[model samples]
Target: MLILSLGRAGDMNRNMLMALVAIAPLCGCQTSNQADYMQIGYGPSFDVAHAQCEMQKGSVDQGYIAIGSPGFVAGAGIGNALGNLAAEDQYMKNCLILSGWKRAPHGQGAAAASAVAAGTPPTPYGIQRAPGSWINTALLDWSDANNKCVAGDKAACGTRAKLGARLRAAGVNPAPV
Candidate 1:
């Protein structure tokens, strides 16, 4: 027979919160570029840049982990460890910018609102496909499935097939993955 006081539970919760805050910086925080937090204008090759950055960062993180275990001294110093953990952040941002991302105006693509006010349908954004949303989804699905195929992830491939079918239904025949 045991009874826990509410005060004790509150104290336990407070202690847990403090512990999490203390360890926030030390955890395996995903390396990200400042640009990742920003909403940039349209970019045709955004997916390619994003994919490259993610692939490179993942490799960097995995390599560091594999080479820097508890007893390993390869990544000994704090600066070196942090560097290894975030080596690709800047590279990713640069890649994205180079891929045509730009700082968009605050009221980006206000044409839709203006068109509505004038009682006209707004044209699609420049460089964006018209009524091709399914193509984008299918492309993304195919890319993910292709990446996971070697890892024996058949589910992702099935998703790609479904998305491809949707694309075909939408009048854009996607190539088989």
Candidate 2:
């Protein structure tokens, strides 16, 4: 009887050990995918790259650049550390966008409108006024117009009035003022 009891206890112990082994992963003891990415330093880089890409694509606003600047820097740092020029470029582009570097048409409209309103004087097609000024104006105008439209003011007539003084000041031609 004693031997039989000991044998039963041993079996029970083995079963318990097996059960623990099975449940170990489910008991909050395993690393999550995000955690794994963090461990490999991929999460931060990916996030920065993603943001930079979006900004370059003009899907994100310039104001958000400040927020994503650090991410871009970190991403670039990581890419450089890993000796990946492609990744570094991707991150650097994002940083530039965030730093108010205008790329293309995404921010053009706002600039035109702002130039018109600020009266900063319009640049004849080939003329230039400061490095990123045009792009900035286009972006600002686009964002303002978009916001007004979304708020049920698609006409943008009101904004035109408000920005008129600035436009006149800037010596923008064909001014209403």
- Give TM-scores for every candidate, taking all chains together and pairing residue i with residue i: 0.29, 0.22
Name the top TM-score candidate: 1
**For residues 1-177, what per-residue lDDT tens digits would candidate 1 score against the true structure?**
111223345655664465456456876665443223322334444346567656765444423222323222222333344665556555665666665443334454354435535864332233353235556645655665766765688887687677767777878776644
**Which pairs clash (backbone N, Cα, C closer than 3 Å) in model 1?**
none
What's the CA RMSD for each of the models?
Answer: 18.3, 20.2
Displacement of residue 41 (Cα, Å) in model 2 is 27
In model 2, which runs have C-alpha deviations exceeding 4 angstroms?
A: 1-81, 84-139, 146-155, 174-177
Candidates in order have lDDT scores of 0.50, 0.41
Residue-wise lDDT of candidate 2 within 1-177, one digit each (tens)?
011122345654664465456545544532212111111111233345445554454323122111133334333333333343344445555553444332334445355445545854234231333345654464345445555655788477566555544555666532221
